[model samples]
Target: MRVLIAGAHGQVGHELLRFAPDGCEVVALGSAELDITNAQQVAKVVERLRPQLIINAAAYTAVDKAESEPERAWAVNRDGIAHLAQTAERLGIPIFHISTDYVFAGDASEPYRETDPTGPTGVYGASKLGGELELVANCSEHIILRTSWVFGAHGNNFVKTMLRLGREREELGVVADQRGCPTSAASIARALWALAVQYREHGSLQWGLYHFSGTPACTWHEFALEIFRQAHALSLLERVPLVRAICTADYPTPATRPAWSVLDCAKLRETLGIAQADWREELAQVLRELA
Candidate 1:
């Protein structure tokens, strides 16, 4: 099958290339190569490639910066996705789009299910939610995968930031109030590829929203401590600095992050017959890659 991956240079996109299923023709493109924001350019590429499946990994993911550049974020995330959905609908091709957990207001006590109401608190989250809605309205054969706390070797993720700060400073302060699962982009890529394969075989199956992430839930502070622990074990860090757990208010940003963005993966696990790996195991793999 022909698979086209947009934002091939991103964290998740890079992992998609690394972990994509074998025996499929994969074409990867970054923003420079195939600008999704430009409808004409997008149409041209889609027309030429004529891919059987399109995986949209491209997105404006500056959570804090989205507050200042809301237009750019909305253009790339929502408008671009709308274009992809419409084009895919026209060509009778399926689209697999990646979304985020920020869509929730983050006040829930338990894990957020697919049916949970989404009232995003930030421009980034709001734009992503808009894209999700557009896909459901415009495209019939579309799969939206909403994930959280994505980290990988290729991009500017929390793991990389923590490692950098842990090496530079004597102390690292991470928010303890914000709770979510740290999903490895490699895992997401693999799961997305599996779902794409399923869609290829059973085109008539229900194609809609699903939540995926690591098994265990953790706060940023805990995740940072784990990163330091693994880094120390791997001899990546010279000395383990004082990792402090602070509240969200202590490190205020322009965007309002969800206090609890944990997503329920029951439907994904049951429907795909897949088991999620523990966060520590996945973290080990990511750290190894970083090393």
Candidate 2:
């Protein structure tokens, strides 16, 4: 199978490249090589590579920044995806795209299912939702994986931020009211590969949207405490800083965060046999890599 991975330098994309299975010819490109926002570039690359599958790890992930730069965000998130979907549909190939939990309004009391109502409150989420609609509208053979609280050694994430703050400050405040799964890029890569393998073997997969994220949802403060705990155990941090539990109002950002971003992953587990990874275990592995 000839697989093409966009955003190859990103945390999840890096892992996807690292774990390229045997017998698969992988053509991985960073955003510099294949700018999805450029429709002509996308069509040209798809024609040149002619990959059997296109896995889009590329995205405009700056949540707060998207509020100020909606055009940039939409160009990359929505229009870029539309371009890819068009080319993929032209080639009759499938697309495995990564999405976010931010698509939800964050007001749900329970975990957000795939069928749950989507009401994005900010520009970033709205743009991502637009991308999702474009993909569905353009391509029939596609799989959308929505994840949350992503962290890895290869990119800027909550874990790295907390680790840096742990080393610099005696105390730090993290939003405790906002709860979501802290998924590792590694875990996401594994899940996507599993889907790819399933498709390769069966020649088709149950195509649609699914939620794949870390297990045991936690608040930002709790996640920060865990980060400090793991880093301290691994000797990555000489002194674990005090993590203060604060509400969303304590810290203001250009974008409004979901109060409850937990995604119900039972559909993926039951359908594709992909289970939620323990975020604590994944965090330990990331810490080890950083160390």
Candidate 3:
């Protein structure tokens, strides 16, 4: 089976390349190599590759910056996806797209389900939701996997940011009111590889929207403290900084973040028979890699 991976340089995309299943031919393309936003370019590349499956990891992920660049955000998130869905539908190939948890309003007391109503709070979230809708409407065979708070050894993410601050500062402030699961890119890649293998072997997969994130949701403050703890244990930090918990108002940004965007993965487990990984264990592995 031949698989095409867009956004190959991203955190999850890079991991996908590294963890690609055996006996499968993988063609990974970064934005520079094949920009999804360019419809002609996308069509030409997909036509040339003729991959059996396409995994779209490309996205405009600047949450705060999306407020000032909605057009760019929509172009990459929504328009790019529309192009892929149409092309894949034309070629009779299936697509696996990654989405985010920001599609929710974040006011729910319990975890958000796949059937929950979407009310994106910021331009970034709204654009991603648009992409999901476009993908569903344009393609018949597709898997839209929504996740949250993704981090990894590679890429600019919360974990890397916290590690950098911990090394440079004695004190750091993180939002305590907001809570969500921290998923590892490596885990996501592994899950995608498993799904791809299943599809290749069985010739079909259960399609539709699904949620898959790390187990044990936590606040940014708690995540920061854990990072410091692990970094200290690894001797990667000369001195672990004091992580101060603060409300959303204490640290303002251009985008309004979800106060509680935890997603329930029961559907994923029940339908796909996939289990959620312990985030702490994944964090330890990432720390080891960084060290």
Candidate 4:
């Protein structure tokens, strides 16, 4: 299978490049090389590569900044995806995409299924939802994997932030009210490649929306505690900082974060036999790499 990966320098995209399985021909590009927001470039590139499939890791992911820059967010998140989907539709090829858990309103009491009603509270979520709609409208063969709390050895994520703070401060406060699963970039790459391999063997997929996230939900405070614990054990940090549990109201941002970002990934597991990754184990691997 010949695959083209967008957002090649991003957290997930980088892992997709590193963990690409054998027997697959991969061409990955960063935003500078193939700006999806530019329709002409997208058309030209797809024409040149003629990839069997396109896995789009590109996204405008500045959650708080998106509140002040809705137009920019929509341009990249919605319009950019529309270009990719349309090009894929024209070529009669499949397109796989990454989406966020923020598409749901923060009010859900239980884990959200793929069919759950979406009500985005922030500009970033609204823009991503727009992209999802555009992809569905444009492409017949597509899979949208809505994930949450993605972190990796590369890129700026909550894990890196907590590590930096752990080194700088003796104590810190984290929002305990918010809950979500912390998925690693490598795990997501593995899932996507599994789907790619299945499609290559079968020539088609049971393609649609599916939720893929890490196992066992926890609060940000709890996530931070684990990061410090692991980092200290790995000698990545000299000492573990005290993480104080606090309400969301204590820390304000321009955009409202979804309180419930846990996704029920049973559908993917049952259909594709891809199990939810245990984030604790993934975190250890990441910490070891960082150390």
The predicted structure with the larger lDDT, 1 or 2, is: 2
**TM match of model 2 to true structure:** 0.99
Q: Write the residue-wise lDDT of candidate 4 on 1-291 in tens digits.
A: 899999989999999998999999999999999999999999999999999999999999999999999999999999999999999999998999999999999799899999899999999999999999999999999999999999999999999999999999999999999999999999999999999999999999999999999988999999999999999988999999889999999999999999988899999999988899999999999988887
lDDT for each residue of candidate 3 in 159-264, tens digit (9 for 90 to 100) = 9999999988999789999999999999999988888998998999999999999989999999999999998999989888988999999999999999998999
- Model 3 TM-score? 0.99
* Deviation from native of the Cα of residue 39 in model 2, angstroms: 0.4
Q: Tell me the deviation in Å of residue 97 in model 1.
A: 0.5
List the candidate 4 regions with Cα displacement exceeding 4 Å. Answer: none
Error of 4 at 189 (Å): 0.3
Worst 10-residue lDDT window, candidate 3: 268-277
Every model's TM-score: 0.98, 0.99, 0.99, 0.99
Model 4, C-alpha of 36: deviation from truth (Å): 0.5
Candidate 3 regions off by >4 Å? none
Task: Evaluate candidate 3 by giving its C-alpha RMSD to the native, one decimal.
Answer: 0.6
lDDT of 1 by residue, 1-291 (tens): 899999999999999998778777899999999998999898889989999999999999999999999999999999999988888899988899999999999999999999999999999999999999999999998889999999887889988998999899998778999899999988899888888777667765467899999979999999999999999999889999999889999998999899998999998888775466687888898889889
Q: Point out where model 2 deviates above 4 Å.
A: none
